[model samples]
Target: MQHLLSRSWTFFIGLATGMMLTLAGSGLASKPQDSPAFQDAARIYSILQQIREFYVDEVAYDALVDDAISAIVSHLDRHSDYLDRNEFAHLTDVTSGEYAGVGMELAITEQEVTIVNLFPGSPALEAGVVAGDRVISVDGQLLADSDAETLLMGMRGPAGSLMHLTVQREGEPELLNFALERRQIDVKSVSQRMLNDATAYLKINSFTQTTPQEVATALKELALAPQLSGLILDLRDNPGGLLDSALEVADLFLDEGVIVKTRGRYYEANVIYFANTGEKISGISIAVLINGRSASAAEIVAGALQGNRRATVFGEQSFGKGSIQSLFPVQPGEGVLKLTTAHYFTPDGLAIDGKGITPDRFVPSQVVLESLLTPIINPLPLNTVVAYQGEKKIQIANQDNQLRTALQALDHPD
Candidate 1:
């Protein structure tokens, strides 16, 4: 199945900020009208104006404003951004889950613009853009020292417009240039496939307002198989989304008991979410896949299943992120504070902060053929399955191999 993966540095940074805000809000009362903080803010504004008039180096107003905004946001939290008019509009479009652009996520690291991940079927992917590509220039304009937001702005434009990008790909000496047409790209948050007659695979890319309904529909299709065996819930690179959606998804798999608990500064923010008792899948074996990129809501699902012994997890450790943010609108089309409101924990009382879920069977990902030429049936000898690790890929001849090792274990009861 075609799957899209996303790494969410944004959520990590935002949660850190929210946690600090929660701490500050808990002990401090509303400041007086003449508070020192407000006075300091006024003084700083005046000092900036004075610098513009007296500094030896001529400074552009726009650059100064951008720098000021960046500085302020940097101090508050990672998720809270100071977006100017254009940037604000762009952020809104992206968060709203629809936009017209090249469909690639970019980040700035040490003054170099880097492509993080390109959306599947996007203009950027179609133009051969891959992760880790350094964007040297865009439309003949050098962007090596540009901020990530600025570089992204340069890449985006009206739909149907053409843009040129000069990228440096790994192991390539000559700089490659790509002329791409911008298009309206919709980021899909869900995907499903039948792994076999009885086994199905469902991957949730992200949780959105409509994710619960989408997941329900996918499950219905999987249920169409007369003798459904089990499912492989793949959350390898899912970044996460709305907390409510996470709860809803967990409820589907869990019959009863606490799904997750949240703790925050305010008593009101602390909450315990439970699953409905009589609505769980019985006698169905489930296996979940995770990696360093699986985070937030993905962690919630993994934690729930692991706690209840409902699924056998496989893959590397997950991305350790367990903080929750609550968005508070501050102004009309101006800005908002995405404050950290709470910390979440699995029902088994495991802290997920900086501590990821350890898979029961650690299996490193391997690049297998798109379609297995010869499908192995059940009750095959254990040594026949292949085990791929490191640079050396080896094949086995009988039932004693690793794949058979897992299959044999699954065949026998715990």
Candidate 2:
């Protein structure tokens, strides 16, 4: 059913604790292994069989498992939960070369959806969907005053799906239109370029399986330039992927220190990650850019670099996800239990779960408000007084703004 798919989940503490106490008093003391646990197991099996045979409607076996997993994981922390087979496949396939969409990460605001970053060779990039372009309409349907995320949901579908979108670019008088057919998105995690003769720009979209090697290659490419002095490591819209990859990437910039430490309920889960003594970019001025979309491994990198005083962090706060999820095999080859096994702390022992990593210098974004939003809710005229919709967005207007800030701060070091 459409209502039963799931994500992060947690258990009810009072109920769970009470159940355990009761079981301890009545069951474990009596039989050690064959008491309330067995009874409850039998009861659940009976109930499930009864529902399948005599229930009002026929339920698929797969649906039953999905619902069961969702219910069981409901009482864990918000970061802990289950992943169905399809979801697990996609998750494990994160570094896979192809996905069906225009291949761009978007930041939605009150009035528009801005392109945060575009995947290389993606339809959006090929059709010139540059960062900072705000979408106005899709397939001739005006999205004026419409929630940008909702519009984006409509954009992704089956492969070969065609979408005609109109976007407003900054400092442009006319809107640009493109007709793009959705295809498998090819991901390019590391993008590097020279901002100037002495400055380099390196962006890691997400920490994927190949990210460590990609980052190494990117750095080598940047180092090819003779006069590279300052570097901008962009993790603005990077939704983190692999923890190990993040650790490896952070090790590249740090000489020696604890990158992060994980605390789990079980002793086996708790662990500490330390950086080795090989800093490829040693003595090079580094500036790390993070925003609301930076999370998980991205936060790990930023916190590690910042905590060690190896980089100047400049931008908005991060997405505040400090928990680590481990995928335990459900059976030999069926599915996996995506368990939120532990909470990770920054090197400086800051709680990053709810409190994100704050930047040293806060630079407000410079956005161009479109005409479409100007008329409609110009919409909650009282919005200025009420709940602001500009919540958590990657607020860097363009790549240059943050890079400029980084270069200035690095040059001055005063």
Q: Could you give candidate 1's per-residue lDDT for residues 1-414 as a string of tens digits?
A: 001111233211001111112212222356775999878778878978998999999989767866775677688534444545555455445543567877765544345655645677888898788877888888888775565546557666788998898999987999999998988877665688775566667887665446677787888888788877777778766666667667788788877788888787878678788888754445678777887767777888888888777788877798777777654443455444445566788888888867878888887644243233545454433334555656555554443222333444444537
For 1-414, candidate 2 gives per-residue lDDT tens digits of: 000101111101000000000000111134444678778767877878988899999989667867887788878765444655554444444433345777766544454556666777778888888876777887787778564434555665678888898989987999999988888765668898887788888998776657798899989888888887889898887766667778889999999999988787877557788999889877689999988777767888999999989888998888777777666655645665656666788899997887778998876433333332343211011212122335622222222455566767766678
RMSD of each: 7.0, 11.1
Query: TM-score winner among the candidates?
Result: 1
- After TM-score superposition, the amount by which residue 280's alpha carbon in candidate 1 deviates from its true location, in angstroms, is 6.8
Of candidate 2, the 10-residue stretch with the lowest lDDT total is: 14-23
**What local distance difference test score does each model get?**
0.64, 0.66
The lDDT, on a scale of 0 to 1, for candidate 1 is: 0.64
Q: Candidate 1: where is the Cα deviation over 4 Å?
A: 1-31, 45-66, 76-80, 84-88, 105-120, 128-143, 166-176, 277-283, 367-414
